[model samples]
Target: MAPSSNTRPILLIVDGDPEVLRALAFMAETRGYGVIGCATAAGALADLDGSVSCLVLDQNLPDVPGVRLLKQIRDAGIRTPALLMATSPSAALQIQAAAAAAPIVEKPLLDESLFQQIENLLAGA
Candidate 1:
């Protein structure tokens, strides 16, 4: 689907590391998705709404674990699709994210697949 009003679908990217957040924001924006970078889980959660089409979250945040945040997102009745970024996902982490209806994105996040995954999550293709 094409963006409406020249406004792309919003991607809320949360990561504790400044560099990673900036890089992801740049990439998303370049790909034509509206981007919002959050350094803390609280900030991301605070910004959640129907406008946020997808969430790309780091496994460990300064304030809350990504899985916990994902769970909170689901519990709050926010149906936005979320992708959990983990360096090396364990079975438990995978299970946890799945329980919250989020899929895991293995980290060192350098791949075209990430964008495709986001598109798939948003069903924008």
Candidate 2:
């Protein structure tokens, strides 16, 4: 289905779980965001661009950690805001995410917080 919003901010979500990826993409699309879901960090890196309004990356990826991927994205000069999805993140991971300015969204996204975070990020973008 087409996005509901005219602007339709693009969101790139990289997750290792197919189910999680599909669910997140559908949720974002329903909220009027254009969603590009990928199963690997490499695909996410390749798809990274200025057009993307935000990113939702899973912490446990096949090729690399979500935080590491964010670093690569920044190193490549893309300042797009990102949300790192993790379950009970470690102190080091949390520190790294803070360093990269990517907030950690807990997994099993059970409430509207994820959408709120996305909107907040987009608003500041």
Backbone clash count for every predicted candidate, in the order shown: 0, 0
Candidate 1's displacement at residue 79, Å, is 0.9
For candidate 2, write residues 20-103 as lDDT tens digits: 899999988787888888999999988887788899999999999999999999898888988899999999999999998888
lDDT of 1 by residue, 1-125 (tens): 33564667899999999998999999888788898899998999888777888999898899989998888888888878888999999999999988877778788877876777788888843
Query: Against the true structure, what is each candidate's TM-score?
Result: 0.91, 0.93
Off by over 4 Å in 1: 1-7
Best by lDDT: 2
Error of 2 at 53 (Å): 0.6
TM-score of 2: 0.93
Q: Which runs in model 2 stand beyond 4 Å of their true positions?
A: 1-4
